[model samples]
Structure formats: structure tokens, C-alpha cells
Target: MSGYFVTKGSKFKGRPLTTLPVVLNQDLSRIINSNLQLKSSHDLEHLRSVAQQTDEWTKLTVRIREAAEASQSEH
Candidate 1:
């Protein structure tokens, strides 16, 4: 699924922060986007480990992580 990240603060907040759109497999997308709360960072890490089992998903996750770091630096 494709998604955009919206800035939370004021001053052009509604604009998308990252230029690239995220594309995830249906199962992965469902798990990540689900309402269920991850209990802790370890849970998230475990999820990432599972997703990284596929080479395509591993690359996508790296790109997503880099984009997120870049966006954070901009603020």
C-alpha cells in the first residue's frame, strides 16, 4: 500500500514530508496498519525482523528508514 507522512506541527504541516511513496505487501501492510498496539520497541523490532526475511522488503524497509531519518532532520 502507498502512503504519505503528514507533518504534525504548524506552518505547512499538511504537506507530505517524504517524496517517495511506501509500497508494502498486503500481509505486512495489514499488520503494520492494524489498530493493535505494539506493546514495545522490541515488538516492533521483531516485526521488522520478520519483514526483513524477504530481500525486497528488506530494501524497502531500509529506504523507508532513511526517508524517515531525513524527514526528522528537516524539522
Candidate 2:
């Protein structure tokens, strides 16, 4: 239920690019201590590399909720 997401490279429309979706999971420090080398092959890749300490992740969660509400209102 809790994991990270890595997206793939973009698609082409004419001369522009589009977004793609891909997911990958690396070994967490709680799981492994070795350094990881990831290849660049995506237009967008999101990672939850660091563990949230206190209210750090909370701010992001709140911002996301606010954005969602704003989007809903725009519709």
C-alpha cells in the first residue's frame, strides 16, 4: 500500500513530449545500506527515498488536499 513510483519516458505529439507512467522500488535504508545507481529513462520519476520525520510529509499531504479541492471547485 505504501511505495514509490517511477515514470517512463514521454511520448511525442509533434515536436513536443508527453508524460508516461512507470514504477520502481529501491531498497530502503531500513532494508539496505548500499548506494543505488538508477538509470535515467523517464520523463518523470517520483521517489520516496527519505523517510518522513515529523511534520515534513504532512505539509505535502495538506498541499495535495488543497490542490484537489481547488481542482474540484474549478469543475
Candidate 3:
């Protein structure tokens, strides 16, 4: 009935546009904290490490993509 809804009979419903960014950011923070063991999102050393280590960068990118895909599929 509302603008957020796809249709009365639709199986998938629309979510607030702002939700994706919030979810993605939370996912990013979780990955950085738990996987990368970084204290701050702005850690320069982590950035340097990612830049220097191809494997680390690849892993990070894969995790981010997975998280984004999962979030999108949910909506």
C-alpha cells in the first residue's frame, strides 16, 4: 500500500533507501575489526598493508563483495 512496497502480491518488498548504506558500513566495520584486527577504520597501517599485500587486498575485496551481495539479496 505504501511507496516502500513493491506490489500487493509481490513476494519481495522494498526497503528504505538508506538501509543499504548503513548495512554495508556495518559489514565493513565488522570485517575490518574481526578479520583485519584493526583498531580504527582510519588506520593508515591497515591501508598500507592492504596496498602492499595483494592477497590481503583480494580477501578484503571478496569479503566486501559477499557482504554487499548478501545485503542486496535480503531486499
Candidate 4:
């Protein structure tokens, strides 16, 4: 069995192994391309707005902590 890397730069067997030719999902290429596409100003502004909003940040932190606790409990 072989493990896949979330990143392309991952190496294996002391070689620069990146993508696996077989068992490759076609959607994986699309996903990479979509991620590579530059984000628009609207997206940046939205992220900035979320960061600027203290209430939102606090809510997000609380939610993240809740998720962490839930995952730990599931283990």
C-alpha cells in the first residue's frame, strides 16, 4: 500500500516522489487548478472583514474549540 500526500512536494524512497500515475482521481487536477486560481478582491475583502470583526473571530474560535472537543470525545 502507498500513502498519498496532500502536498505535491512530498518525497518517498529517498526520491522526489510527487503524484502517483495510477489511482489518480481526475477531480484532483481540477481541485489543484481551482486552488491555484487567484482569489478575487471580494474574497480578500470578505476574509479581511471576518478578521476585523471581533465577534465573528470569537465565534469562530469557539466553534473550532467545540469541534476539537467533539473529535477528542469521539476518539
Tens digits of lDDT, candidate 4, 35-59: 2111344443454576599997676
Q: Taking the tens digit of each residue's C-alpha lDDT, what string does model 3 give over 1-75? A: 113222447464576445543444466664534554333444435655685989977887788787678778989
The CA lDDT at 47 in model 4 is: 43
Q: What's the TM for model 3? A: 0.47
- Give stretches of model 4 more than 4 Å off: 1-45
Per-model TM-score on C-alpha atoms: 0.32, 0.36, 0.47, 0.40
Badly placed stretches (over 4 Å) of model 1 are 1-53
Q: For model 3, what is the error of residue 5's alpha carbon versus the real structure, in angstroms, after optimal superposition?
A: 39
lDDT of each: 0.47, 0.35, 0.57, 0.44
Write down the lDDT that model 2 would get. Answer: 0.35
Q: Per-residue alpha-carbon lDDT of model 2 for 1-75, expressed as tens digits? A: 122123436653685322222212221111233232223422113223322434644654454456556667989
Which residue pairs of candidate 2 clash? Answer: 6-22, 7-22
Q: In terms of TM-score, which candidate is strongest?
A: 3
Backbone clash pairs in model 3 (N, Cα, C under 3 Å; residues 3+ apart or in different chains), count:
0
**Maximum-lDDT candidate:** 3
Question: How do these models rank on lDDT, best leading?
Answer: 3, 1, 4, 2
Candidate 3 deviant stretches above 4 angstroms: 1-27, 30-42
Report the lDDT of model 3 for residue 8. 45
